[model samples]
Target: MIFMYMSHLECPKCGATYDPHKLTQLCACGSPLLVRYDLDKVKANFKKSDLIGA
Candidate 1:
């Protein structure tokens, strides 16, 4: 089963993509990276109560 549908990591500048499970840092192109998530799965599977210390 996929883990939380954490789809992937992407660089907005160079459009480079990386696996979410591995250790990641600045993109190879020397730009900051961004996180992308599977919002569909999150909306369906997650709830406000799932938040911790809320």
Candidate 2:
């Protein structure tokens, strides 16, 4: 089993985008940028059984 997570930084206020690999204090418009991830990919790459450690 392998565990990994990929994400991207998105600013809700200014609609700005940033790389998730780097550290950012806030968006250019003075709004907090949060990390977003792909849910469909997560469901495809992993299984519920895997989470149970079976």
Candidate 3:
């Protein structure tokens, strides 16, 4: 299953957003980028039982 709920990468300091599908290094301010996800979509598509084995 292709579970890709990641929407973008955000810089904690500069609040800059980057495309999550691309290879990104860091923000313009040299801050490490953090992943942002579509949590609502993930919750709708995923279940807690899905992790029972893996």
Candidate 4:
């Protein structure tokens, strides 16, 4: 299994966070949700070249 770096989904307007595993679209505040990641986990191993074939 591959480990993912995504932390959670957050609402920009209300600053609310939701689980990324569940089905969701807009936040309760009626604002679009944003994806938040644990960049610290990927920063050391990720690079632009990783997306070349993906």
TM-score per model over all chains:
0.67, 0.67, 0.74, 0.70
How far is each candidate from the true structure, as Cα RMSD in Å?
A: 5.6, 3.8, 4.2, 5.4
Ten-residue region with minimum lDDT total, candidate 2: 1-10
Computed on alpha carbons, the lDDT of every model, listed in order, comes to: 0.80, 0.76, 0.82, 0.80
Clashes of each: 0, 0, 0, 0
lDDT for 42 (candidate 4): 77
Q: Taking the tens digit of each residue's C-alpha lDDT, what string does model 2 give over 5-42?
A: 54678999988889877878599999999878867678
Best by TM-score: 3
Residue-level lDDT of model 3, residues 29-49, one tens digit each, is: 999999888898788666754
Q: How many backbone clashes does candidate 2 have?
A: 0
Better of 1 and 4 by TM-score: 4
Tell how far residue 27 is off in model 2, in angstroms.
0.4
Better by TM-score, candidate 4 or 2 = 4
List, residue by residue over 1-54, the lDDT tens digit for candidate 1. 446778888999999998888858689999887888888887766665466435
Q: Which parts of model 1 have CA positions greater than 4 angstroms off?
A: 1-5, 47-54
